[model samples]
Target: MTEPKTRRTRNGARLPADQTTPRYLGENIEKDLREVSERTGGGTMQSRILVAAIALFAERGYENLNMRTLAGWVGLKAPTLYNYYASKEQLLVEAIELGMTDFFSYILDGIEDVPREDRLFEIVRRHAGYKMRHRLIARANDRLIDPQFARMFLPEDTARHFSGRMADYRHTVEELVRDYVADDALVSPKVATIALLSQCDRMAYWYDPGGSMTPEQALEQVTILIRRMLGIAA
Candidate 1:
């Protein structure tokens, strides 16, 4: 197979896209981060900068990450950085969208031929797993209350574009949950589903890979939590 292209974190350092560091915790995190950055642009310089920014924002509040400091982290002149991202807010919005897309893709990719009840559980696990794994990305997505993200990253037209694709996966799970509730396979499937999504959607704010939890361990815990939420007695 052809070698994959090299990618960089925000610091302009060269790192292989396939490589995953302990700092990032899992291969999927790096993969997802890079994929999202590539959606905006290519190369290690751009991707690494975006990854660094997310990691920083996760550590420090958004206000702490001004353009000068962010540019310094990426080893670029702050003004030149604007060529890539118009402003810090715009950059944040794009990153959030990329993060969401990365996560939704993972959850959608895992759905298979299992029964509807089991399918709902699987969806919960994968969605939770992704969030617990890529907490920074998830957190950045959650921090999208800024008007820029609402107006720019997720305009009605953009939301519709995302929905057109995301709808299939979302609808599949919703219907599965609805059916499970009807069949008594689950209690409060709708509530369970929403809660599960919330759990996955806010990983970035609280998940610290340096802390006591590993991504796999977090996934396991989240899976059990979601099962209990669904009254599945896991």
Candidate 2:
């Protein structure tokens, strides 16, 4: 397989784009911040900085970016930028936090009030849909935030809450799987969880619009796969 291309974090931190670290949501956040800034005729300095950083980082991978360049984008001196972010790394962390929160929030929205039997289907469909909708950001997160890269920035480098949120949300999914057992569904909880994640993860590598399966169809098929995995009566 070809190696994943390099991508920049919203904070302009250089990392691989083939992993899972949340940062691109800052792009959306930045856009919203800019819109509010324009409409209200004012925006927080920090918000402008994030918006600029999102653009700069996305255009130029982190390796080609630096605090000075990022500061210049926001019309700030490099030192002034530090007033908002201790380091570019911290800023990247903030971006990642934004991205992850949005990611899971959509999943929660998808599953909300969904019939219990359809909950898993909705979760996977929404997840795949969200990722497809924001494929670039998703790819960047996947490439950049995999286990090793994340370890490089934990504890001392980021807020405890932001750093741990991904793990916490992931455990939440596991809890949802356990619910299947509680309902006396005939699935092995372990297999169901693993299968679900694996199936979803494959979307990142193989989502093609014109390749026989529409996203709607793909989701329906996966939903049925999960139902079968759970041994729910077909």
Candidate 3:
């Protein structure tokens, strides 16, 4: 029997000729893959590559997604793909960070202008809307930051950065919950914030754009549920 030749990139990175079986990132991979397959028509080459990378990572898991596979998705040679992202780790980090930043900004933008009484609802609406619109990205971001995966796959500094960002967002939500809770409400704001966010975030896993419920109806129902949970009157 002849030994199969191992392929190497210009920088001596090994390229796997065959796709490796996908590893489990978490329970969300199956749902993420479904959403990834439904997406199409990203704007520019670099943007399209990023979009494709997210989809591939969701479909193939971190170890199974190779440069050659990603490059093929973007219609570029493997070495040429390196010009955009030097390594799989670099690409994964960038994709995760970009998605987090965008998700945060989308939920926070114009929040300062919202009336005090309406601010919580506004933030909840945006959060739910973004998840419905970008479910695959949301799922990928969530999985990549899982403590087990983060500690094992991401550099310590990168993991810390994501943790800090997540903490900041949580604190922001806590403050909002504190302000919105009724004067005599018995709930702790921090606990309520966690519960509220968990409810909103889970939408990414189950929300169906094509289902009987429209995004508008879904957001309205979510906001109503949030209000009742917070003891706010309808």
Q: lDDT winner among the candidates?
A: 3
lDDT for model 2, please. 0.60
TM for candidate 1 is 0.59
User: How accurate locally, in lDDT, is each candidate?
Assistant: 0.60, 0.60, 0.73
Collision pairs in model 1: 7-44, 8-44, 8-48, 9-48, 9-49, 10-48, 10-49, 135-204, 139-204
lDDT, candidate 3, at 13: 61
lDDT-wise, the better of 2 and 3 is: 3
Residue pairs clashing, model 3: none
- For each candidate in turn, the TM-score is 0.59, 0.61, 0.78
lDDT string, candidate 1, 11-40, tens digits: 665543332231232224455556556654
Off by over 4 Å in 1: 1-43, 55-65, 87-89, 110-117, 145-172, 183-188, 200-218
Model 1, residue 48: C-alpha shift (Å)? 2.9
Candidate 2, 53-132: lDDT as tens digits: 54445545444556776775566788888888997766776656555655677678546588885676667788777665
TM-score order, best first, reads 3, 2, 1
> In terms of lDDT, which candidate is stronger, 1 or 3?
3
- Candidate 3 accuracy as lDDT: 0.73
